[model samples]
Every structure is written in structure tokens, then in C-alpha cells.
Target: MMKLFHSPTSPYVRKVMACVLLRGLQGKVELVPTSPMQNPGDLQAANPLGKIPCLVTEDGTAIYDSPVICEYLDGLGNAAPLFPAPGPARIASLTLQALADGIADAAVARQQGRAQQEEAGPTPRQAAFQERQLAAIRRGLAALEASPPAALAEIGAVAAACALGYLDLRLPELGWRATHPKLAAWLASVEASPALSRTLPPTA
Candidate 1:
């Protein structure tokens, strides 16, 4: 079985795990919990960047980053491909995935900002940085709401679900649902999937 380095609360890792379950390849892969912040040697050996969701193939080829890992898993089973083949649909899915991933990135930045404020009292600079991330998230959410995905069966939808899930998990104060009802509704439907439900980030 392939091995995956991941953290229970990582949205990126959640995306990959969701993909694995969606593809019916759960039994083919093993999850190894890891934290990049701690820089574990095993993670480093698998991925120099020490990132979670790194998949080590049977041939020992290590694939880092969620996009790559998810694609690798999508190919493992005869189930419908989460990532559409190269074409207009593929372009659309990849674009949506990028936007969703951007939201996740901004959310993480906001979380780090909170930590910085807690460690060393809130500062004008930290506030400014957070405002910027919030703005980015707002823009991303608006984009998704304007043109919702045709269906939540592609990589893009998977990514968007995890991104919104992370926001709900780590930054509820943002109140994204109030501003983007359409996106929220779509996310709610996607979250109903058994595969996605199984990969929900651990609380506390």
C-alpha cells in the first residue's frame, strides 16, 4: 500500500484523503500522521519541504503538495476521475481548484496572524496583514458564488469544500456564509458526501 504523510487537521491533507475515499482507494493507501512545523526526519526524507499529504508510491517516488497527491489517488481506481481530462472541463476544474486552494492559503495566514498576536500582543502590522488575507478570502468566495460549480464531483469542488470546511473550523468569525449564501449552500451539499464526512478535520 502507498503511504501518505499527513496531519489530522490539515485541509490540504483532507482534500487528498477525500479524493482517496471518493476514488474507492482507501484500502490501497496508509495514512502516517505528521506535522511540518516539527520537521520530522521521516517527512523530510519523503519530501524535502516536510509537507503533509506527501504520498510515497510503491516504487518509492515521493509526491508532495495536495494537488499532485490527489491526482495520484484519482488514477488508482476505476471510479470516475475527480480531475477531468485535458479540455475545457479540465481547465475549468483546475481553475476552480486554484481559487479554492487560494482561500485555504489565506485562511492559514489568518490563523498564523492570530498566533502572532497571541504570542506578542496585537500590532498594527499584524492587523494590516490579517485585513489583506480577509480581503483575499472575500474575493475568492465572491468568485465562487458568482459561478457555482456545475457539480461537486470534480477536484475543484473537492478543494472548495475543504477550503470552506477549514474556514468554519479555524476562523468562524469571518462569517462567510452570511455574505455568500450560494457558496455556502453548495458547500453544505458537498459536505453531505459520506467520503467528505469521513475526512472532516478533527476538532480540538
Candidate 2:
């Protein structure tokens, strides 16, 4: 069996968990709740970056970062493929994945910055940094609004759902759903999928 360092509220970890469920690997993988900020020694031992969603394979080969882990899981089961084959479709899926991941990245950074600001008060540099993150999130939302994914059938769609879920979790003040109705509708349509529903980021 494999072991995964995990956190219930991390978008990246949630992404990996969704993929695990989609690929029917849940029983085969152990979820070890981890706090990366606390820098647990075992998590560091498996992944130098000390990130959650780090997968330690049966033989102890560690795989990391959510995208790589999802791709790895895609190879292990008979379930429909999340990743597309080598072709234009694959490229499109990958590009979409990148865009979705970029949104998740910016949103996470912006949330962290907000937490820091609450403790230390906002500085000009931090405020500028946060504005840049916010801009990236808005642009990503617009792009997806123009062309939302087709449910959670592929890696890109799964990623988009996870990203938007994060927004609902940590940045509800963004009011993204009102501004990106199409994307919001798309997400609403798929949020009930077994993979997505089961892996939802924790509210607390």
C-alpha cells in the first residue's frame, strides 16, 4: 500500500484525494494527516519540500506535488483516464490543468498573505503582492468562464473544480461565482460527483 501525507483543507491535497477516489485507489493508499507548516520529520523524510499529498509508494519511492501524484495514480487503475493520451487533446488538458493550478496557487498565496496581514498588519509590499495574486485569480476565472471544462471527466476539469472549491473555502469574499456565472454553473453541475463530493476541502 502507498502512504500519502495529507491535509483536509489543502486544495492540492484535496486534488490528490479526488484523483485517488476517481482511480479507485483510496483503499490502497493510506492518508496521513500532515501539517506542512509544522514541518513534520516524516513528511520531510519522504519529501524534502515537506509538502502534503506526497505519496510514498509501496517500496518507499516518494512522489510529490499534486499534478505528478495525480498522473501517477492515473496509471494504477482500470478507471477511465484522467490524463489524455499524447495528442492535441492531451495538450489542451495539460494547458487547462496549468491554468487551474495557477489559480489555486495564487489563491493559496493570497490566503496566506491575508493571514499574515491579520497578525502583522498589511505593508505596502505585502499589499502589492496580494494584488498580483488577486489579478491572476480573476484572469483565470475569466478564462474558465469563457470556456468551462466538460464536467469532471478529465484532469483539467478535476483541477478546475478543486481550484474553484478552494475559492469557496478560503476566499468567499472574492464573490467569484457572481462574476463568473458560467464557471459557477459548471462547478455547480459537477460538485456532486463522487470524486469531488468526497474530497471537498474542510470548512473548519
Candidate 3:
């Protein structure tokens, strides 16, 4: 069985879990709850960057990052490809996934900054860091609203939805849905997928 090193709270891990469900490969993959912050070395041994959602194959090869894992899982099942096979559709899906990943990354950074302030004393630098991260996230959401991907049944769509859901979970003060109604509606449609519905994150 493939061992997945993941944290329940990680949007990236949730994205891969959603892919596994979508591809009907849940039985073949074993979920291993891991905390990168508490067990950094263990995750680092699997992925040098110490990221969550690392997939250690039965053969012992480790795949880091959600996109690569999603692609590999998609190939394992008889279902339609999570990524388009060729041309513009493929490019658009990949681009949307990248945008979504960017938003998630920004949110993570902002959360980290907040953690730093709470752990120690609030510093001017920390506030600036959070502001910059939140700005990037808002910009990415706006861009996604402007050019939404047409293929709503692919891994890219799943990734984007997971990112938005994470934002709702972690940064409700941002008011993303109020500003981007179209993106919010698109996310609602995507959330209806059985794969996504099964992997919805628990409220924090």
C-alpha cells in the first residue's frame, strides 16, 4: 500500500486525499497522520523540503507535493484523467492549479506570521509580513475570478476548491466570498462532487 504522510489540517494534503477518492484509489493508499512541525525530521526524511502530503510508494519512492501525487493517483484508476490530455485545456487546468496553490501558500505564510506574533511579542516586521501575504492571496483570488477554468471536473478544479475552503477555514476575516461571488459559486459547484464531499476538512 502507498503510505501518505499527511496532516489533517493541510489543504495540500486534503487536495491529494480528494484526488485519491476521485480516482477510487482509497483502498490502495494508507493515510498516515503526520505533523511537520512536531516531527519535522520524519517528513524531511521523506521530502527534503519537509512538506506534508508526501507519498511513499510501496516500492519506497517518495513523491512530494500534491500535484505530482494527484497525477500519479489519476493514472491508477479507470476514471477519466484528472488533467486534460492535451493542448489548451491541459494548460488552463494546470494554470488554475498553480493559482490556487499560490493562494494557499500565501495563507499559510500569513498564519505562520500570526503564530510568530502570538508566540513572541508582536513586531512591526511580523505585521508587515502578514499584510504582504494577505495582499498576495487577495490578488490571486481576484485573478481567478477574472479567468475561471472551464474544466470543472479535473484535479485543478479540486485543488482550487480546496484552497478556497482552506481560506474559509483559516481566514474568515478576509471576506473572500463577498468580493468574488463568481468564484464562490464555482467553489460551491465543485464542493458537490462526491470526492470533495468525502474529504471536507473538519472545522477548526
Using lDDT as the yardstick, the better of models 2 and 3 is: 2
lDDT of 1 by residue, 14-106 (tens): 999888888888888888878788889999998988778799998999997999888878878898999988999999999999999999999
Clashes of each: 0, 0, 0
Across residues 1-204, which tens digit of lDDT does each residue of candidate 2 receive?
999998898888888899999898879999898989998999999999877779999999999989999999999989999999999999999899999989999998998999999999999999999999999999999999999999687999988999999999989998999999999889989998999999888787
Number of residue pairs clashing in candidate 2, backbone atoms closer than 3 angstroms, sequence gap of 3 or more or interchain: 0
Clashing pairs in 3: none
Q: Using TM-score as the measure, which candidate wins?
A: 2
Task: Provide the overall lDDT of each model, using Cα atoms, as 2-decimal numbers.
Answer: 0.88, 0.91, 0.85
- Better-scoring candidate (TM-score), 2 or 3: 2
Best by lDDT: 2
Off by over 4 Å in 3: none
lDDT of 3: 0.85
The worst-scoring run of ten residues by lDDT in candidate 2 lies at: 195-204
lDDT of 3 at 90: 84
Model 2 regions more than 4 Å off: none
